[model samples]
Target: MKPQIACVLIFLSVGIALGECDELMKELGRSKTSLGGLANELVELRQIQRRVGRRIRSWEDKARQNEVYLGRLIEQRSISEGWLARFEEINRKLLAGEISSDDKEERIARNIVRIAEFQAKIDRRQATIDFRIGKIEKAQAQADLYRSRFEARESVVADIEEQRDAKKLLVLTLEADLEACKAGMA
Candidate 1:
């Protein structure tokens, strides 16, 4: 009777152990699936970062081109200023009676026309430069917005990875506990 009772007790313990193992296996499977989903989300975040990087590069290129154009405009303005200064000196000499009145008048008229044309060209170029600068600013703002979004996504991914690691540790601990329980029954 004692042996029979022991056999019954061992059979019941084995059955309970198997049940626990099955449950643990199911939990491990669920955890693996969750990790896989998180991995996919991480992939998406990487793609977003790549796209934002490309946008930043394009914006930088445009800004470089705008800088080159601005430099050219500055050079042109500098040249125009020199011409205006020379014209002023010639007029001053004419007013002091150092040159003939007719010659001075003709020279002054030509200088005026040249100055006006230079001013018109400068104005047009400035308007274009202003437009380009505005575009560059807008693009920079847009790129910054994207960069912030990418940072946010990166933080989220980091958090998910942390959670997944913790979950993995928990699953391992649970597995160890289940194994211990089975060993005790055996």
Candidate 2:
């Protein structure tokens, strides 16, 4: 509202004195052209803002999926750890026993091998999960940055709208003054 008043005051300073109708029409033309351009720019900015909003939603969904996947990975790791512990306990019990059958010895050997292989698999999967988590963090940061840009652009669009309204009022005032000046000439 203040901006509208300021615009009117600025244009009023153009002096309502007669004989300047030609200059007034020229200024009015320039103001109209500027207003049109601003309107186009506002439309473009709003479209871009909507696109940004969609992108933000997409990233948020990705983040939620990543969290669920991460939780599953951690749970899987814990279950594997429990299995490894049981394998070690069995190996200890066999070692503490007296002489055993050949089949029992073979069973003990397989148990040790299984433990080592299972631990290696768990380690690999954990590493992969860690890498994925890093990627997720980076993507989230990018989303935050884009959200900030969208908000700033939104503010700019509002300011441009205000300026456009002010320009419109100025143009109307100029047209009225031009008509009055022409009437005075007759």
Q: TM-score winner among the candidates? A: 1
Model 2 off-target regions past 4 Å? 1-57, 98-102, 154-186
125-184: candidate 1 lDDT, tens digit per residue? 777768877876886777789789999999999999999999999999999999999999
Deviation of model 2 at 68, angstroms: 1.3
- lDDT score, residue 145, model 2? 94
Candidate 2 lDDT by residue in tens digits, 119-168: 99789879978976986897789888988999999999999999999999
Error of 1 at 3 (Å): 99
What lDDT does each candidate get?
0.83, 0.86
CA lDDT for candidate 1: 0.83
Q: Report the number of clashing residue pairs per model.
A: 0, 0
Clash count in backbone of candidate 1: 0
Best model per lDDT: 2
